[model samples]
Target: MLFDTLKVSIVLVTAVTRWKGLETRFLLWKSLPSSIDRLQHFASSRMCASVKRCDLKVESPGFWDALGNLEDGGLDVVKKFFELLTSFPNLATLSLTALTLDPLKLQRVSEIHTLQTLIIHDCRLPRTFNKLSIRDLEVSGNPTEMFPASKEDYGLASFFDLNQVERLQVSKPTWGDPLGLFCTQSNSPISFSNMKVLSMPWTLSLSPTFPSLLTQCPVLEELRLFSQAPKTPSHSKFNQSGATTLHPSVAPHLKIFIGPDVCASTFTSRSLRTLVMASSEGRPHDIRKDVLPILTDIAFPGDLERLAFGVDCLSDPLLDYIAGSFKSLKNLSIFISMVDGERYSSDIHCRKMWISRLSSRLPSTLIRFDISTRFAGLNHSEDVSGEDLNVLMTPLSQRCKKLTAFTMSYQSAARGRTWAWRRSERTGYGSGQWVNTDEGVRQ
Candidate 1:
């Protein structure tokens, strides 16, 4: 079996180079022509030029039907495997699955230059594969008609040059109009100006040119957007007849924002500090008419620490506007359900009166609290005792006296049971359990 998996990968790379003196830089070869001559003798060994990192999965079809009987059909064995990965020179990082290169042999594997991180799945690239200068890039498949059939066609606009990409992820399952691949058509403007991090794909969050494609990522810290509904009443009537506008030169150094809850008030980051919304099987008056008027017309920034939502948009006037607006908040995550209808009601004193009205409106500079729920009328004729989880963790440990950490999880809805609890304010003590589906934590 591939020489006993290369003799247990040379005895786990000589016991991890004799316990971490370091040598094996990481490599995974799943179906590369059954060890293509032992990976061309470890790519001309010298310990394969100190392999930096590599993952290759060519999904064997008898190695492309033996290169369909040769005749350059195998593109010279994929250009001798990118000329043996440009002789490693501290190989940066590469992952390719279901490979299909030849964007002129990926410009000779993008002139190596210590290739910085590239991940591709269901591949096909070659319109000079955007002259790589990779600084982290991810591309997922199903790229509709590989875009650009006009606007003087340069679709994927030479993969947007923000001085050689800082971080970009492009997923396609028909990303229809990613603002025409980030603008062009005599409306010239393209800038990712040292893009920090961006993850987008729910077909570009139902594009109405998705808030003008976050004004071309100007100093974006982190942003993730994924969607599977909401926003289509003609793009919520062109964002309430204003024909779109989030311009504070969008994402101006935005600090962490995750998508969907209908694009949470189309964003206006005052250097936003971590906000995640996600949750939509649509209709709760279309998420309180498109995310409660952009969360009552955005103005969040008391150095907002972290906040996550979804308890059907936690309304009580959005938890009294997030406990009277984030007083330098400190990590809070929530996703509730308890399930019993008329809009949630598995009553345990109505989920401890919504966690004692969100622990008397949060902020005493709280510290780490995560809550997840499901219970949906529990099941097996209801059960959750231990005083219904101490009536939900004694009003969140007596309204957060600088809580060090607290987590609660439930999930019963019959035949999918789970229960968890944890507490640790410097181990003042707390723990609970009942999770197992083929054995997973049960104490």
Candidate 2:
């Protein structure tokens, strides 16, 4: 079975090399149909060197047990895996998803010379996650609980210097337990001076000095701060927190800022041209209008081109204020969170009033509009008809003469699809190319 999978992989690889026009992607792990225990049978010495990239997920049901018992001599199986990785001196990307590895095994893997991208998911940083000099890095999923309880200092932030990390994504800590999960007690800011693109959950307690360090990243262009449920509040604030001053234009190179549920007022920057905010059900209704005024008050050197609002908040004033404020705004996006029973109001008048108010404030410079909502109370096809969606975007769409892209979620778009499908064909009103397919689009 193992030999057969390898033959197929090799054949597919050849096909990929031959058919340059093929748009489909082939996933070896999914296509390979053999138990991992027989891996040695497939990866002969010659083939080992030919493999360029490999992903070894630790969460597979019996994988850890197999790797841990690699030698019947214990742990050597993992050692052999590294041996294979080292053989591929040209390896570019290695992704380990939802896998846990022994620390000693990681230390040995770090010795490999030519690794460009390394990703670890739901895995503990084995001093090696830090020691490697990979150009791209991604650490996702929940923080592991098996880490030592006494050493919270082992948090990922302390493990490495992210100054050279180009694309960094430290996803939210879903289950925070066993103290040392994702943080250390330093209370000082960590730095990512060379990070070009950063996507971190809002709950991350950045060191107050983080902004100062960001200034070092002269090439940094995009910044995304996602708000996870708040982490233990940090006592540090701007002035009272005795920390170094945060430079006003530290992120001067930044052109985009995407975040939701964050008090936009807390941010002060001069280079931001694209702004995205995600609102949830518990969000403050007036935050849009309240925060927009403050955000606009801070002068940005560049023209604001795109503005997006996530639908967690029920307030329409926020949308209205945005339309009225940034006259140079080119694109607008609205994403609605799933409404709970309490938020569901049958009164169409209230809904109409909200839409009309938003429509009245539409800005003339806008070119693209995206509006989406998750209807938790009603099945879109069963009860809510498509007209509802048409009405929803009608107000915003009618005003933007340059409107080119209009996107909505599957359910949200389904409601608007009936009308939008037609309007989109006539006026090119369909969701943008990105709206139909972008991971974590709303969140």
Q: What is the clash count of model 1?
A: 2
* Model 1, position 192: C-alpha lDDT score: 64
Candidate 1: stretches off by over 4 Å: 1-34, 37-94, 97-104, 107-156, 159-257, 260-263, 267-386, 390-443
lDDT of all the models against the reference?
Answer: 0.56, 0.51
Q: Residue 263, candidate 1: how far off, in angstroms?
A: 5.8
User: Can you write out model 2's per-residue Cα lDDT over 299-324, one digit (the tens) per residue?
Assistant: 66237887765444445455555655
Residues 207-226, candidate 1: write the lDDT tens digits: 56756666666677887765
Q: After superposition, how far is residue 139 of candidate 1 from its true place, in Å?
A: 4.9
For candidate 1, give the lDDT. Answer: 0.56
* Model 1 error, position 32 (Å): 11
For model 2, the run of ten residues with the poorest summed lDDT: 231-240
TM-score of each: 0.29, 0.59
